[model samples]
Target: MPQVNLLPLPLIASTRAASNAIPGRRLRRFPGLYRWLLPAALLALWQAATSQHWIAAQVLPSPYEVWLTLDYLATSGDLWLNTAASVQRVVAGFAIGSLIGLVLGGAMGLSPTLRAYLQPSFNALVQIPVLGWFPFALLIFGIGEPLKYALIAHAALVPVTLGTMQAFRQAPQPLIEVARVNGFGRRQIISAVVLPAAVPVLFSAFRLAFTKAWLSLVVVELIASSEGLGYLIVYGRQLFQLDLVMASVVVVGAIGWLIDRGFTLAEGRLLRHRLTPGARP
Candidate 1:
């Protein structure tokens, strides 16, 4: 240290700028490479673990083995059919629950009368676990599709309703006043003012409800079903087909991820619409 000559902040900024410039120039060439890189690395790691026999191969099959089983399922068309069934059930449950939740929640949040009559019972019922409802669901609808739908719907609706109610209740007072001053009727106020303000929260509730519905479908299928992906896992477990089990697990995870991604995309589009030039009051 002949001399303490610190690089000036401007020079540090210039260096960073120069370094980033090269990557910026190369960005077009590497578009989307990072997207698949993480998954590939994970697959590689799993393959390495299986090769090293860190856990018994029979217990935790290699990535390739799982893929092969997946391929078999795919080729036979069973995977698509089963996946479609599970997806439909999730959609059905989410749709029904979200619709009812929005109406009930909006009423409860907006009017004191509705809240007084409904909130107590709804709050208490939410405490009951999804598993606990299975027995009653089975008794009500039997071991049929309706039973699963009923269970999934109940599991999903509570959170959605609660979230919607809270979100609507907390809409800015100034905005509400503005809506009324603009001669908006009660229906118009809710449609134009309250709903827009609460959209983000409502969508969040939808996402939660969808996740709950998906989980409920799996549980329902596992407990009382002849088909579906969860049934596939149950079958694999019973038959001691670890590869099949792992493959089915991977499928379930992938499907759930895809559903979430779809919802996120929809949320983004909806938000974009709400943010346009003249959307708000």
Candidate 2:
């Protein structure tokens, strides 16, 4: 027998349509189109402020002037040189920090005794801000690449360690039991079940670590380095070239955005298998 249609036809059809809609797909496909709106508005506001003299030209150069400075820096190779130095520092420091963090965090996660022994000291140390370590770092490493590397690595270590420990600890007990029931060894269970579950969290940790390392590199450069993006900013300020300072800032932000986007893409690819069937790419 045919089922009675109790609901209104319009409501039933609308519900069906809504259920089948793929909003996330649209968002993924047109990300730039949507994401550029805020930046565009800000640019407009900046231009308006400059034209209206609401901000002094000496303090906040026009966008066109900043663009010209950026072009000059790029053409003269200054921008690339400074940027490359900063990138190299970030890579070296982040790699070392992340490796150490993973080892310590994994050990702590797998053993309650180690966690109890280390966590208190770790928490206490991490409470000290990055700048607070500058004096000690200077005494130990001096005003050189070693100082930059030490500081950047220290900035990265905290987030990665915390994220790794929490991720492993929070892994589903049901999954672990299932693995054990299947005769899996500790290593096998960790490799197949625990790591996969922790991938998303670890990736988030990497993002945070990378950002911190990048910022720390800049701060270290500002304090002691003769070259790098941070130096360019300080140089501009010393010479009263606000446009140059702004240009360096713009480059820094763009590079950071690109790095973040790269990590996001990697996370999506690495975790694709864990996504729901209808999840966006």
Candidate 3:
């Protein structure tokens, strides 16, 4: 099949030049260091405020107190248990949601008739926030694991579906015409041209979906769960243990940062390959 380069030569040359530049490496490293400045400042402020009693213990515990609480939870294994539960829910729901989204979105992209039939309803349904579905899901699933899964799945599904549809729809018409001129069939064209072109956008969609799923998982656990990081927060609040609440919040943030970093690395590798000259099929 004939392959067309949608990007101009000058753009490709510039990209290659930027990638090899010493300034680009410095620019990347600078951001990693620069991004920590604010967080460090915030931590310092937090510590000072608590140490000086500017904030009450009931309002916000000292950083040392939060650290002790985190250590205690870790030693007791409750932290690991709750963290695992939350991660498991997000992974399961995200997988199910993204799979279904890919199928539905692909079909819609391939068939205008199917898109016409489904797009309106999907848009209307997806407008409802995860919390808006909480009461309805609770009614149907009755505060069980299924309730949490349903909400998280819905959260993941909306973004992935929209992204997949857009990615497929945005495939260059010239490329499609070129594929057809080369006697490529529908499946061949999709596999050889469309999928490769859509990789970057699809990765972005997956990242967004995972974020939504993770957030929805926490919210669901907060409202309905007996155990999970969110439940740990609720439990801490009920007992007026601000330190435990802070510890759980810290764990949540840390996990989110780690997962986002993982996504970034994965995206960087895939995009590096995709952006390489003569890489596309």
Would you estimate the TM-scores of all the predictions?
Answer: 0.85, 0.85, 0.87
Query: Which pairs of residues clash in candidate 3, taking residues 3 or more apart in a chain or in different chains?
Result: none
In candidate 2, list every pair of residues with a backbone clash: none
The residue-by-residue lDDT of candidate 2 on 237-267, one tens digit each, is 9999999999999998999999999988988
lDDT of each: 0.88, 0.91, 0.90
Instruction: TM-score winner between 1 and 2, please give it.
Output: 1
| Pairs of residues at least 3 apart in sequence or in different chains that clash in candidate 1 | none
Tell me each candidate's RMSD, in Å, in order.
3.3, 7.0, 11.7
User: Predictions ranked by lDDT, top down?
Assistant: 2, 3, 1
Query: Could you give candidate 1's per-residue lDDT for residues 38-60 as a string of tens digits?
Result: 99998888888899988788788
Cα error, residue 146 of model 2, in Å, equals: 0.9
Model 2 segments more than 4 A misplaced:
1-31, 181-183, 276-281
lDDT for each residue of candidate 3 in 63-182, tens digit (9 for 90 to 100): 999999999999999999999999999999999899999998888877899999999999999998999988888899887888888889999998889989998998888999999999
Q: Which ten residues in a row have the lowest lDDT in candidate 2?
A: 272-281
